[model samples]
Target: MTDPTARPADPIRPTDAEARTLARDLIAHARFAALAVLDPDSGAPMVTRIALVPGPDGVPLTLISTLSAHTSALAADPRCSLLIGEPGEKGDPLTHPRLTLQARAEPADKTALKAHYLSLYPKATLYYDFGDFGLYRFAPLAAHLNGGFGKAYRLTPADLAQ
Candidate 1:
């Protein structure tokens, strides 16, 4: 027999229904997220805000400039992290759910991914002319979703894997 105090095993391996719900919330509620990449010089962490476009695969993609600090970092080290949460309001922001996705940034083939990103964020077309603007895909390796009040879940890429 199992101990009564022991928590039940997770039915989901990488992510559960709750985790998916949280992921959807993060994609819908947050428009911009801070992308953190490793700096080449000191190997430190560098962060920048980027316009996020969620893909059907549940990964977030963005267009970044080669000149941007975060993009520079990505060029040096493809490993990166993304933080998405409710912008601080008058009330306790902790009450809202937040998600942090650990990912790998890769230069994506500009065929389908570009069209998908642009379809999701038509407004970005205005800045498409920038030479530095290039298609980058952030493939999530893992994620931590916190739904406040000690409710949190961990998700892995396998969760969203097709």
Candidate 2:
């Protein structure tokens, strides 16, 4: 006999193409994201809000200050995650789609990235050359995309890149 209260397994939405596009769009259009890093001393997880822009490889690019706690943590441990997506005001928050990316943060050539970064954040031009600030790229290793109820996918770097 079947258990009446048991919920059926959520089916994967046949929107792989769409999901891939959405994932890339999320990174491209996002102005900010929640960056989670590991604290060097305590080894506890820490999260901070950060500006987001597209990098050379359709990944995330960010400018972080060396003096900040998150930057220091990244220097010690490059592993991090970024939560991208925003919930609509009308729907159940859980029903909204979001992408969680597991990545490694590495310093990029600032000079190469400066113009691109400036185009997105023009105001940053004033402090663009600040010595304490740096350009870092997020190299996605894996990703989990929740595209609403019954819509979920585990994506790899290639999936997102395409």
Candidate 3:
């Protein structure tokens, strides 16, 4: 006889393997993420949905216009957080297996990185006509993934510091 009540090892604490899997999964499934930029004057969070592209290094890249409020916020303070996942139907959303990334945003240099970003999100090319469309790179400082049903993990840059 075995105890069915026994939990399964409390899931794995984010290993390098887990981190890579989570990052890749988010990249593949998510089309957009809510970018949270801090209001420089009030130091409060302001979130907006922005199309995102994954870079070779797994960092997120986005195209934003200088006219947008979020873009203005980013210009004032580059530190931000992004949230991506399916909204839960019940219970706490945070525990429902979502991905949140603490990141730093910077205007991407018009070089290989920017080119790669554009290639990944070709549809965004249409927005270039806006003139204010500029590439912003969101380099991950840390990440947390809660793959519902008790699968949760945390990752930091040091974990992927290759």
Report backbone clashes per prediction: 0, 0, 1
Which portions of model 2 miss their true places by more than 4 Å?
2-15
**How many residue pairs clash in model 3?**
1
lDDT of 2 at 141: 95
Task: Give each model a TM-score.
Answer: 0.81, 0.89, 0.75
Candidate 3 regions with alpha-carbon error over 4 angstroms: 1-16, 87-97, 110-115, 158-162
Better candidate number, 2 or 3, judged by lDDT: 2
Superposition error at 121 for model 1 (Å): 1.7
Q: What lDDT tens digits, residue by residue, belong to model 3 across residues 10-63?
A: 565645686667666775566688999988778888888898877666667777
Write out the backbone clash pairs for model 1.
none
List of clashing residue pairs for candidate 3: 97-146
Tens digit per residue, CA lDDT, model 2, 3-79: 99999875655547888988898888887899999999999999999988887678899999999999999999999
For candidate 1, lDDT tens digit of each residue in 78-158?
999999887456667887778898999988755567677777888888876577788787888888887675677787776
For candidate 3, which ten residues in a row score worst on lDDT? 109-118
- Model 2, 4: alpha-carbon shift in Å? 14
- TM-score of candidate 2 against the unseen true structure: 0.89
Worst 10 residues of 2 by lDDT: 9-18
Task: Sort the candidates on lDDT, descending order.
Answer: 2, 1, 3
